[model samples]
Target: MNIQETQINFTILNRFMVLKKKERLAHAYLFSGPMDVGKGETALGVAKLVNCENLSEENYFCDVCPSCLKINSRNHPDVHVIDNEDGGTIKIDQIRGLLGQVKMRPFQALKKVFIIRNIESMTIESSNALLKTLEEPGGNSLLLLTVSSLEKILPTVRSRCHTMPFSALSLRVMARRLMSDDGEFPQEAHFLAHFAEGCLGRARCLKEDKIFIQKDAIIDQFILSSKSEDFVKKILTDKPKTKGLLDILLSWMRDSLLVKVGVEDARLIHIDRLDDLKFFVERYSFFVLNDVYEESVKTYKLLADNLNVKIPLLIIKEKLRYE
Candidate 1:
C-alpha cells in the first residue's frame, strides 16, 4: 500500500514501518485523539502492512495483494473492527466474546487485529473484562483501541497499550486537501481548515451544518461587541454558538499577532481575510495585541470548562476594547 495516500497519516505509518521492520510492534495499542482525525484509517493501514501477502523491497504493501484487498473491503477474517453492540455502550458480553476470539489463532494473517472504537463508551464492567485480554494477549494477536479521551479510559487499560497520540492537522495541510464528505470543495476551505481546528472530519461536519456561511457574521460580532450593547445582548441569547465564536475570535486575534510580526500569509489562519487581518494588525500595538490574545485564550478555556458562556465572553469583549 502507498502510505502517502491522502487521508492516510504518513507520520504514524512511518513510525509503524520502523517498528515492524525491527520486529518490535506491540501487541496492544491505544490510539487516542479526536474521533475525526483518521485514527481508524491508521489502524487499518498498520493491519495491511503486518499481514500483506507481499511486502515490497522497500517494506510497503502491494495494494493488490489478497490481504490488502480483504482489509480494504472489511472482509478480512482475522482483522476485526468491534462495535459497541449495546446501543453505543460496549457491554461485558461483547468484550467477553472478543476475549474468546483473542485466544484463538489467526484465520489467515500473520496476526489477528481487533479494533475497538471509543473505549469511553464501554462501561466499567466491560472495561474490566477487556483488561484480561490485554494482560495476556494471545501469541501473534494485536488489539487496537481508538479512544476519545485518555482520562476516560481505565488507567490499567491505558497503561497496558502502547499509546499513539494524534494531533490536529495544520492549516496548510488542511487547505491543500479540502474535499468535503460529498466530494464538494469550498472556496473558503482555507478558512474552514482553520475554523475546524484542522480536524478534517470536524471540518466536514461544520460544512454540512453551514457554519461556514456564518463565519463573516461571527467575526462581525467580535468586531461589534465593543460598540453595541444591543448586539451583545442578541449574541448572548445563543450561548452555545457563542462558544464557537470565542474560538474564532481567539483565532482572529492570534492571526492578527502573526500578521503584525511579518509572519508569512501561509502561516496565518485568517489568510482568507488578508486585507481585514492587515486592518486589525495596524489597530493595536504588540503589547496590547498579546494581552488580548492571552485573555482570549483564557476566556476560551473558561468557556470550555463549562462556565456560563456569557460571563467569559463578555469579559473577552471588555478585553477586546483594549484600552
Candidate 2:
C-alpha cells in the first residue's frame, strides 16, 4: 500500500518533508510516540527518500528506481534495519556487529541508512557502546531510532538525535478509516478508537481482542447489579487479574463521561458497549464519574508499582458502590 493511504496522513508529515527538502536532514532522528502509530513506516519512507534515484519535488521515492525496488523487496544493500533477535532484546553483540558494518562505505546510494526499531530494547552496555557512533555519525550514514518511551533511552544518546513526537489518531480519523475499510465496524471503530486513548495501534488491537466483548458484558453487569456485596465479590473473586479489569472499568467510565457531555468526536476505546455507556451516564453524576476516573488512574499507577492488586480492586468497587 502507498504509505500515504495506509490510514495515516502524510499531509501532516510535512515536517519531515521540509527537512528533506532543505537538504539539512539530521544525521540521526528519533521517532517516539504511542505504539503502532506508523514510526516504522515513516522510517522506511525516509530511507527510500534518501536513496531514490528519480525523486520528484513533492514525493520521496519514485517507486520505480532500482534502489526503491530493492528497499521495497527488503534487499537494499545500503539500508540496514536492526531489530530484536530471538529473545526480543538487542544484544551488545548485535550492536557491535552493526557498528562494524557501519565502518564500511555505502556501495549503492549516496547515503547508507540504518533503522533500529524498538531502541528501548537495547541493553545498557549496547546503548553505551553506541554513544560514540551516535555522537560522531559517519559520513553518508544516517541512523533512525524509534522508541515508544523516550525516557528509556540514555540522555546522552537522546541529545544527539532530532525527535519527532506522534500523537494518537483522532476519533473521526480512525472511524473514517475503519468505515472505509469495513463498514461492519463503523460503530465499534469509534468506541475502540476512544478506548485506545489516542492510539491507533491499540484501537486495532481492541478490534481483535476476544476479552473486549466479555469486558463490555462485565461493565454492563457492574452498572446494573443492585446487590453491591455479591457483585463486587463475584467480580473480584472470579477474575483474579484485577489490573486488566480495572483498565476496562476506567475506559467504561471515560466513555460514560464522553457520552454525558455529548462529545461527538470522543475517541472511545470501548465503542462496542455504547448502550452500557449511555446507561452509566444517565445513572451517574459528572462529579462522581470524574472521581472514579481519577481513582482508576491512581490504581493503574499502583498496579505498575507492584502494589497489592486486591486492595485497589476492593477499594475501587467499594468507592463505586458507596459514592
Candidate 3:
C-alpha cells in the first residue's frame, strides 16, 4: 500500500508536508506500531515527497515523475532501505555499512533517505552504532525507521529522533478494504475484520490461510470442549498462528460479555453466533468473562514481547474450566 492510502496516519502525513514546505523537517523519524499498519508506506511517501521531481499537492508526490518511479522501484541511489523483509536478523555490519552511505552526499535527490524497516531486529551494537548519526544527522539526510515495538529501542536512540506512534484503522475501514477484494474470505466480513485487528495485511494473510473456518472450532473448544488445555497446548506449540486463534477466542469472550450486560449490537463481532454468545454468557458470570478477556489480552501482550504464554493461559484455562 502507498502512503497516501486511507489507512495511514493522516495527522503525521499532513504534519510532514507542512514541515517539508517550511524546511523544518526532522533529520530522523521513528515510526513505531503494529506491522502493516502503514509505517513503512508513509516513510516511502516521505522519501518520495522530499525527492519528487514534479510535485503535485503540497502533501503528495507526482507518482509519474522519474524520481518517484525510481524510489518506488528501489532504483533511487539516494534512497536506502534496510528491511528484514525475509525472516532474518538485521546485523551490525549492515547498519555500519549503511551508516557509511548515510555520511555521503545525495547522488540525485535533495537529501539521502534511509528507510529502515523493523528496527527492532537490529542488534544492540547496530543500534548503538547509529546513535552518532541520529545525534548529529548533518549530512542532509532523512532517516525513516519503522519498528513493530518501541520497547527494544534504546532510550537514547528514541530521544534523538521524532517518534510517531501509529494505530490500526477502524474495523469498518479495514472490513471495507477486505471486501474490495471479495471472495478471499469464507466468513462474514466484520468477523474477519475484527479478527484482523484493523490491519489489511493481516486480513489478507487470514484470507490466504482460510482462517475463517477455524473460528467456530476455536470458540467451541474454549466454551464447550472438554480438552481446552490440550487444545491450547497444541496452539501454543505452533506459536506463529496462535494470535489468530487468540483473536477468535478473545472476540468470542468479548461478545459473551456484551451479551451478559445487554450491550449487544452492531458492535458485536460474532453476531451470527448470538445464540452461542447468549448461552456462553449464561454459563459464566460477568466477572468471569471479564477476567477471561483480560487473561486473553495478557496472553496477547506476552506474545508481543516474545515471552512465554504459559502463565496467562494457565489463568485462562482455570477461568474457562473445561474440566
lDDT by residue (tens digit), candidate 3, 1-323: 34444445677777788898998998999998898788877888888888888875744777778889998898899998887757687888888877788778898889899988998887888888888778767568899998888888888988888999988888887776676656534237777778777876777777678776677778777556656877777878877768767777778888888899897677898887887777778877788889889888888988989998866876776777631
Model 2 TM-score on a 0 to 1 scale: 0.80
Per-model TM-score, in order, reads: 0.75, 0.80, 0.81
Model 1 pairs whose backbones collide: 1-61
Q: Which stretches of candidate 3 lie over 4 Å from their true place?
A: 1-7, 85-88, 180-187, 220-222, 225-237, 241-243, 283-323
lDDT score of model 3? 0.79
Give one digit per residue, the lDDT tens place, for model 2 in 258-305. Answer: 888986343555555566567667766788888878888888787678
Candidate 2 residues lying further than 4 Å off, grouped into runs, are 7-18, 85-88, 182-184, 221-242, 257-275, 281-295, 318-323
RMSD of 2: 3.8
Summed over model 2, clashes come to 8
Q: TM-score of the candidate numbered 1? A: 0.75
Q: Candidate 1, after superposition: displacement of residue 175 in Å?
A: 4.1
Residue 228, model 1: lDDT of 48
How do all the candidates rank in terms of TM-score, highest first?
3, 2, 1
Better of 1 and 2 by lDDT: 1
